[model samples]
Structures are given as structure tokens and as C-alpha cells.
Target: MRTVGVEEELLLVDAESGRPLSVAARTLQYAAEAAEPAEDAGDASIAASGEFAPDEVPGGSIEHELQQQQIETDTVPHTDMAALGEGVRAWRDQAITAARRAGARVIASGTSPLPVEAAIVGKPRYLQMVEHFGLTTTEQLTGACHVHVSVESDDEGVGVIDRIRGWLPVLLALSANSPFWQGEDTKYASFRSQAIMRWPTAGPTERFDTAESYHSLVSAMIASGVIFDKGMIYFDARLSHHYPTVEIRVADVCADAADTVLIAALCRGLVDTAAAEWRAGEEPLALSVAMLRVMSWQAGRFGIEGNLIDPQTLAARPAREIVADLVDHIRPALRENGDEELVERQIAQILERGNGAMRQRTMLEKTGQLSDVVADLATATAGLEG
Candidate 1:
């Protein structure tokens, strides 16, 4: 309940070709105006030693993610939704213009529909990753918008993650953007989710009851050398030891920055409300990991069209109704955050026709080519245009 912020992993793509652009160098060069040595010291990035993500953009510029293809943009902390939107919009618009000047475009989808050739800009860290994780990892170059909400305590972070797991599917369904893969429709809402899961440390996490337990597991995993660093524990939800927030990593990057803000608001609101309920002596409702996995699979495979089992009532509900129910549940948080209208609009858009997957499919059906998918992606990225 303290405040909320977001880290968006954006794909740098060729403006005319829609292919992934290896412009982290050029993009970082553009950010040189703001990148001081002290400001660039982000929690050790997987991208490169020089790669700057959350910190380089003080005034607003694209930062780096773990991969060379990624530009991690961040926001100023805000307790209310309006301030969150303003910060996020300003940052995204700056990134888009900077990317445009470098012959690139910014798209925030969870995965690129077409396979962006593994033409990494060739950094040592990227090379290290390739040697460690291999070609499949490079081939699955995807992006997601990570939302972090500050908590009053470590216990609150754990509890927030516990209750928030049930809603991960709903959030993913609402933000699913990777419909096509390797120039063909993968017939799923978020091929990005699956693609990202290819990594050994990626995807949904096992339930944990305490911060001690979570920290112990991560420490053991990192020590075992399976995960290179703490940040590599890419779970649906994790307590960011780096920050005091329960970070929701389930959502794909929305094509639009507005969509990104909505996702962040909804996520922050849910955590705040759930924490409040927990404080009031309400038991944290949790479903089996099996149930959560299946629901997440349904969301990834069929999106809002698929049926999902409700975690609270144990009854199957249409994904749409469930999403509406979630929006309603988070209304107080959204209203408090000054994003009531956007939260409603984003939910309506998800339930109305479908997510990015549906729109990408329609575009492909109309033109019968990956080129059309790129066009649709461009349309989806419109919110970030300067």
C-alpha cells in the first residue's frame, strides 16, 4: 500500500521491417546524455555490464533488460494511479521517440510474433548467456512488463503473492500479446508466455508461506548455479529482494503504454486490497499449484475464450466474467489511484473482442502474411508514439 511502479521490457524493432533491432548500443548511446556512472549501477543486469535499465532514464529514456533486444523503461513511484500513468506515459513516449530516431520502433508485447533472428548486438554478457543457456534461449527473445508494488513488510510481500496467484491467469489473459511465432499464428493468446517458459528459471513458481522460505530457496538455487543471479528467478510473483515490493512478473508487456499502466494499476490495487483483507484477519485464499498451472495454461492457450476454474468458489467461469469480477473487486484501488476509467476500459477491451492475439489473427486473416502482423503490432504500440 506504500506505492507502486513498473519495469517494462520493450522490444527494439526495425521500423520498416518489424524485425528485432539490435539497437541497445545505439539506444544506450542516445541515453548517454543521462547515463552517469553512478546512475547506471542497476542491480547487476543480465543484459551487459554497461547495460542501463531502471536508472539511466532519470528524465525519461529507454533502459536495458537482461537481453540485448530489450529496453527496460521504468516509472517514478506513485501511490495513486494518475501519477503512475503520467510517469509511465512520459517514459514510454521518450523511449519511442529515441527508438524512432535510431530506425527502430518500440513494442511491449510479451513475445514477438515473428521470430526475430538472433542477431544480438554481441555483448560479453549476452555471449555468456548463450554459452550458459544456449540457442533456444536466444531464439526465444521475448519481453514482458513487470509490475512492482511496495509493501509495508516482507510478510506482506509473501501474502500479496499468495493471494495474487489466483488472479495471474486473469491478468495474463487480459494482456496476452504474442499470437504468432516464427511467421505463423501459434493459435494461442500468448506464445510469449510459453516461449519465456523455455528458460530453466522462468514461469510460475511454487507456493511459499514465508519470506524466509522464499529467500532460502532463491539463495540455494543461485548457489547451485542453475540461476545465474537473484533476478533470474522469473516467477509469476516474487518478492524482489532488491526492493520492498511484491513484484508481479506474470503479465506480458501490453502493446500500448496505456495498457501497461492499466495492468500496473490493477496489479498494485489487487496487492493492496489483498493485503488489507489479510490484515483484517481474512484468510489468504490459495488454489493448488496444479489448479493454478492449468488455469494459466488455459489463459495462454485459448485466452479469454477458454474456461477457467475460479479459485474462490471453485466453479468454472467464462474468462470474461472473471475479468469483470476482478475489475470490480479492484475498483476501490483503481478509483483511489485515479485510473478508474482506464481500468474499466482496459478490462472491457480484453473481454469485448479478445486481446492482442485476436487482433493479430484478424490482421493476418485479412492480409495472409507476417507483414500484416507487424502492422497490427504497430497499431498496438500506438500508445507509446511521441
Candidate 2:
């Protein structure tokens, strides 16, 4: 089975006021101290003793984002959803604990509930981004969930990406977790999607039938001075430059671990199904980028509450029906991976209880307080406290 990995960005917020805090540097420092090696051994003694090496936390797995208000955690690639869930939960809990020690709380929110004076981290690359993009880069306080599924080759990966582009909006709708932004309900399910769209290279990409074409387009974008680098190729789904995988960058940062697992499972399934089709020499869908953008917007606007543009017909259909179609589309892959039953149950539960956006709205309606919303979100981020 192709392994899947997840990267989630979480906001560090004030425990009492629900305001985002720029304490990621402090929290990471605390984590490092907890994992660092004891200072006692000489270089020769350390070389002699293999066990005395620095017990430091893996720097690459958990790190700061563009802003100090947000931290990102990535899981090891796993073939099983349960293992992925455990990894995600463990990392999240660790982040929360680290933030608490730093006098803040980590909330798995897509956007901050309170207004924030965004503080950019003092990193050279991020500083360049801020200088180039200006306000667009500085205003980024959004968090998102990205799932990476291994692909055998770039050819196969681009093939899978081409076929799977239409189905991404459903994933967006299912993971819609950002309803409130800057203390006001944006009235859109995943307002973070809108916020991130300020990037010139963000959102869906035109079909690149081959790996060569994908590389060509990326090169052209950089050469044209439209983007800083290949990393700015922020398509909804793209061939990962750093990994042998296709990374889907649509969903909001889920408030619950289970939802994150479900998204990962479904994404892996979609990639598998698309690869199978590629093996059978099936032609990829030729959906227009303009239409794909519209569909994406519809999903972010209504989530599962209204209609979504159906992947098959590109016609507006009830969100439930669209979600059902997605399930059927990837059914074979799920069963093959022994995830059919698990994904079905998760999908039913999500449909019944609602996505994070609906739950947040419902909580605010009952409590009539934004702080209550943040409190409930923090509880949910811990587990199933909601």
C-alpha cells in the first residue's frame, strides 16, 4: 500500500482570552529543552557511548511556520490509518503541552478567533516572502492540513493528480473548519481558503498531462518572476518537490484527530484509485481550471450545508449527494487498503454531526460567545470534548 502522511498547522492562543499569541519560538524552545541531551560527556566519551547522544526532538518533524502564532506538525508516512491517527494525536498533544509550558495553548483552528497583529518569524526565506508579497504575506494567520501520499514515480504522480483534481472540493467541504475569522463569523465555512487565495500561485492548477509539463510550468512561473520559487506552486494538489508524493493542500486544519485521519484515509484512497485508472490507460478528466476554481469556491462557501459542484457533471448538486459520489468513486481503493469500513463509519459520523464549521457555528449559537467558541474548540482539539 502507498503510505500517507499528514502535516497540520495549529494556532497558539491565550488560554483565557482566546487570542492568538506569538509564542511558537518559546514553545519550540521548551520542547527542545525537554528532548535535549544532558551536558556531561566529552567528545571521545560521547563517541564511545552511543546512548549519550543528544536526545533532541527531530527538528524537521515539528517546526515554526511563517508566523510565530502558528506551529506545524508532520507525521511519519504510514500505510495504516490507525497508526497515522496515533502519530497525529501524539504530536498534537506534545505541541499543546509545550505551548502550555510556554504560557499559551495550542488550538487546532483554521483561523484565529480574535484579531491579531501578525508577527513574522525572523527567518531569511520568510523575510524575503514578506518583502515580496507585502501585506498578503504579513496577513497570513491561517492554518491548513496537507496530506502526502507516496507515488511510485513522477509520471504516475502527475497522472494521479490530473485525475483527482475534480474530487478535491469534496475534501475541502468535508474538512471545513474555519467559520470565524477576527472574532466575526465570515459566514463561509472555510474562510481560511479565501484568506490564502491572496497568493498569486495559490489554488487549483491547470492539467499537466505529464511530469515534463508540470516541471515546465513551474519553471515558467519562476522565470516569469510571478513566484519566488517552486515552493510557491500552491496548487490544490501538486507533485511534491521534496518528497516522492503528491501533496493535497485543500483542507482546513481539523479540530479533531479523527477528522484528520479520515481526511488522510480518503486522500490515500483517492490517489490509489487514480493510479489504478492510470494503469488501465484511462484518459484523465479534462476539467477546466476556471470550473475547478468555481467548484472549490462553492465547497468553501457552503461546506456540506448547501450544494457543491459535482465532480462528474460539474453541475451543482446537494452536498450530501456530492459526498456520496466521492465515496463511491474511491470505494475500491478503500476496500483494497482495508479502510472501507472505517472510512464509511467516519463519513457517516461526519455527515451526521457536521463538519467543524457547522459544529463551531452551532456552539456559538447556543453559547452566544466567541470565547466559548474558542474554549470549545480547544477542548475538541484535545479529543472528543465536544
Candidate 3:
């Protein structure tokens, strides 16, 4: 079995006001202290031990994001969903405790509902991004859930990515959690997707059946001077540069831990299904980047409320039907991985209770206040805080 891991970027908000707070640095200091066994152990202990301070965590698991308003947690890769879920929940609670100490709270929101005054992290690379990308880098306050599933080889990884590009939008729709931006309802389920697409290289990618072709395109992009390096490839899904895995980066940071796990299970299933198809000499679908872009836009706009472009025919279909088709297509892989029941249960729950976007809108409608939206977000995140 290919072990899978997840990385979630979360927003730090005021505990009372639900407004975003720029306290990531302070919260991180607290987290580092909490991670250490002794209070006075300090940087030396962290440096000398050279490992995550506790067993349930992993080194480099928690870190600062581009903005001081955001913090990120990464899980140690695992084959069992139970262990992965527990690890993620542990880190989330650690973040919540760390933030609470700083008079802030961590919320798993795709974007802040109130006005965003992004505080860019002071680093050379970030500064370069600010200079190179201008407002696109400065105004970014979006959070995403990235799932990394191990692959045996780069060729297999590229093949999986090539075969799975069309299905990426469905994942995006399932994880749509950002409905409000700048204190107003953007009316789109995932405004964050639209916000992040400002990047020149961010979106669905064309086919790259071989590792050489993928690397060649990445080199070409870098050589063009349009982007700084391979990190900026920003494809919706791509081979991880630092890990022997395929990284799926299309979904928003889910509000619930269960939703995050569900996304991970589905991504692993997608990769496994793709790899099996490749091994059987099945050719990848010839979907155009233009059409895929359209599908992504629709997913972001409607989220599961309206129609979606079915990947098989590129024709519009009910979002539920499309999702059902996806579930059926990946059923064998899910069953093989022993995640079919869990994934189906979570999907049904999502359908019944609604995704983060729908839930946010419901809160806003009931209270007619954005603060209520933030408060509800805090409550939702609190379920996994322990």
C-alpha cells in the first residue's frame, strides 16, 4: 500500500471577534515550546534532538505559511487512515492551543471572511515572490489541503497525474470551504480557487506521460523566467520535488478533519486506479487544458449545488450524479484499500450536512453577520481540536 500524508494550511483568527490575527510567529514560538519536552530546552534541544519532539508528530510538521495569518500542519505518511486521522487531529489541537496562548484561534477556512490585510512573512523567497508577483503574492490569504501519496517511480507518478487531471475538479468541489472574501459573500463556493488562480502557472496541466517530459516542461517554465523555479510550477497536481510522491493540491483546506481524511482516501484511490490503468497499457484521456479549465471554474463556482462538466463527455450534468460517477469509477480502488465504507459514509455526511461553503452560508443567513460565519468556523474546527 502507498502511504499517504496531508498538509493543511489554516487561518489564525481572533477568539472573540473571529477576525484574522497576525500572530503566527508568536503562535509558532508557543508551538515550538510545546513541542519541546522541557521549557528551557529551547532551540538547542530542537537542534540536537533532530526529530519531532513527540511521537504523534513529525519533524517539519508544523510551519509558517506565506502570510503571518496562516499556519500549516503536515502529517507523517501512513497506510492506515485511523493513524493519519489521529495525527492530524493532534497537530490541529496543538495549533489551537498554541494560538489560544497568543490570544488567537486557528480556523480551517479556505479564506478569511472579513477584510484581509495580509501580512507577508519576512523571508528572502517571500520577498522575491512579492517583488516578482506584486499584488498576487501580497493579496493571497487562501489555504489548501495538499495530499501526498507515495509512488514507486517518477514515470508512474507522471502517468497517475496525466490520467487524473480531469477528476481534480470534483475533488475541488467536494472541498469547497471558502464562500466569503473581504467581508462579502463572493457567491462562489470556493473564492480561494479563483484567488489562487492569479498565479501564472496555477491550474490544470497538460499530459506528461514520461518523467522526462514533465521535467523538461518544468525546466522550460523556469528557463522562460516566468516563474522562479520548480516550486512555482503550481500545477493542480504534480510530482513532489522533495518527496517520492504525487501531490494533489487542488482541494481547499477542509473545515472538518473527517472531510480531510475523506479527500486523502479518494486521492489515494485515484492514484492507485491511475497506476493500474497505466500498467494495463490503457491510454490517458485526451482532455484539453481549455476544457479542464472550464470544469475547474464550474466546480469553484457552484461547488455541488449546480451542474458540473462530466469528465467522460465534457457535458454538463448534475453535480451529485458526477460525484456518484466518480465514486463508482474509483470503487474498486477504494475497496482494495479498504476505504470504501469510510469514504462513502463521509460523502453521505457531506451531502446531508453540506460542505463548508454551504454551512458558512447557512450561518450567515441565520445571523446576518460575517462574525457569525467566523464563529461557526471556530466551532467546526473545535470538533477536531482535541
Candidate 4:
């Protein structure tokens, strides 16, 4: 039992337009209540008056982000799987209530439904990002499911990330949610994946042997003026500076919280398995980054419709087969973590209907409308809440 945390970046959506709302007024409104702002706070998004569970107690300290259309919710560090679930649920439920009060809905999509004008968070740091990344990072209106798992040290974080490279696609396949973009079928499971990957440094990562080596590389990036800070080294997997954890940043925003929990559980299992193996003097098997990219691209392009490259053998395998195999592979860790049943149930769901991307695509295609997509995503979100 150690610290694991989640950072769910949610989209601020407009009720009427069904598009992203560039309303930091409301974003900050909810943030203020979550954090309990200055004396001028009685105007909008008051905290729901009640006693939060011990798991949700720390979520009261909310902060703003660099995008006007987004809010970042950090779940309290959890020592147990159940505690993590409770904390994530509490933060999301509180977010939903606050959004309702503001007459806006907190939508969970990687990209907005409509083409929105790019706007920063109205903060100086964000302005610096715009200036630094130019169009690549500035125009990114996307979201991700970032998971942080406990690690021994900075070196352990990178160690986990190194071993985690092969498993990143399995996680991405589970969390795919971006099926439609700008109100059209983009023919990709997670179009947001490609959009977000446009940044200078974001994709399936390579193994960095030690924390010192990782820091040296990042330091070089900073010293060369390629990135503004350590924060801008946005790889698919890396050591989290904010916490002592290996942060995996590949998965898209899962439409269902069950999928979110599934991804988190799987993530937890993967890191634990690798760390344990490493402690036994096992070096992580290295896979080709080129093949990894292709596998990820296939996942994004076809979602559950096509096969993915098995990173180990570099063979194309059906997505369904991959899921069953991955679930079986992580069985030991799942049991050790006391999440066997939860992981199995989640696996059954993926087998039954496919991931969120598949379901959302079917929903949209049947109705021949974009509204159906939005409604389906919201419905999935609501079901997760329940």
C-alpha cells in the first residue's frame, strides 16, 4: 500500500452549443470553490456543503491550468485500490455538481466537438507555452488519462517507464475515446492521440537506464532552449516531477470511469510487475521504437477494428487476442494487488462491446449525427458516475 494518484484533465463544455466553452470564468469558479478562494468567492461554484470522505479530503485544493477550456483534477494519493476509486469518484462527482451549478457540463473528450479558437489559460506560464511551442502546443485542445504509481526513487520511475514502453499500447487500446473530431468521423479510435503527438516530445518512450541519465537528457533539452522547463518534456512515459511515480501519459480520456479504473488497475499492475522483476535482477526487454509507433498508430487508426503489433515478437495480432493475453499476463499482479475481479470484469467488458471508441463510433454511425456522439459520451460518463 503506497501512493498512487490520477490527474484527469477535463474539458469545459457549453450546454447549448455542445462545444468547448472558453469560459475560465466558470473554470475558475469551480476551482475556487474546490480550493476555497478569497473573500470574493460567494459569486459562483460554491463547494457542496458536506463532509468529504478521508480519500477526498485533499481535493479541496484545486488549481487552474493553461487552457481556458480545461480543468485539472488531481485525486488524492491513495494507498489502496479502493481508496483510489473513491477519491476519483468524489472529485469527478464534485466536478459534475459544480458544472451543473454553472450551467455547463464537464465533458470528457480528447478534442472538442467543434473547431474552437485556441486560447491559453490566461496565465503567464501558459502564455509562455504559446510563445515557446508556437502552433504545435498552443493549438492542442486535448485531454489524457495520466496515472502515477508509487516508485522507490527517481531511478525507479525511469526504470518503470523503460519496462513500461512495451505495455503502453495495451493501455492506449483500453482508454481510446477520441472517435470523432470536429463533428466528423475521423476514422481513428483516438484522433486526439495524433493531435497531441504533434508536440515536440510526446509518444511511446524509450528506456532510460537511470534517473541521472534521464535528468541529463532533459537538462540538455532545457539548456538547448528546446523546451521551457522539465514540464515540457512531454513523453509518453516519464518520472513525474510532482510525485515519486512513473507517470504514463499515452491513454486517451476514457469515456467510462470503469475503463478509467481498469486502465489505472492495469497500469498499477504493469509497474508493480516490472519493478518486482527488476528487483530480481531482470533487465526490461527493449522493443523497437519504430514498431511501437506503428502499433500505436494502428490502435489510433482502427481502435478495436484491426490488429496491433505485439511489441515482444513484432507480430501483428488481433486486438481482441491482445486484450485477453494482456489480461492473462497481468493476472499475477492483479491478484497481488487484490484487483483480480475488477480487472476481470473490465476485461469482459472490452471483450463484449469493445473499448469506448468502438461503442461511440457505432452510436454515431447509427444515428448519422454528431449529437448522438456527444450524448453517448455523456451517457457513458453518467454510467461511470453511477
- Against the reference, the lDDT scores of all candidates come to 0.72, 0.85, 0.87, 0.72
Predicted candidate 2 versus true structure: per-residue lDDT over 1-386, tens digit per residue? 99888889999989998888899899887766554343432111111111221223111255779999988877767788998888888777778878899888888878887788879999899999998999999999998999999999999999999999999999999999999887899989999999989998889887888999999988999999879788888888998877889999999999988999999999999999999999899987778989998999999999999999987787899999999999899999999999999889988999999999998999899989888888888898988563
Q: Model 3 segments beyond 4 Å from truth?
A: 37-60, 384-386
Q: Largest lDDT belongs to which candidate?
A: 3
Q: On residues 296-335, what C-alpha lDDT tens digit does candidate 3 reach at each position? A: 9999999999889999999999988999988998999999
Instruction: Name the best candidate (by TM-score).
Output: 3
lDDT score at residue 11, model 4, on the 0-100 scale: 75
TM-score for each candidate, following the candidate numbering: 0.87, 0.93, 0.94, 0.90
lDDT of 4: 0.72
lDDT string, candidate 4, 136-239, tens digits: 75778887888878888886777777787877887787778887776777888888889988777778766678888899888988899777788887888888
Q: Rank by TM-score, descending?
A: 3, 2, 4, 1
Candidate 1 clashing pairs, residues 3+ apart or interchain: 81-337
The TM-score that candidate 3 achieves is 0.94
Regions of candidate 1 where Cα sits further than 4 Å from its true position: 34-61, 121-123, 335-339, 384-386
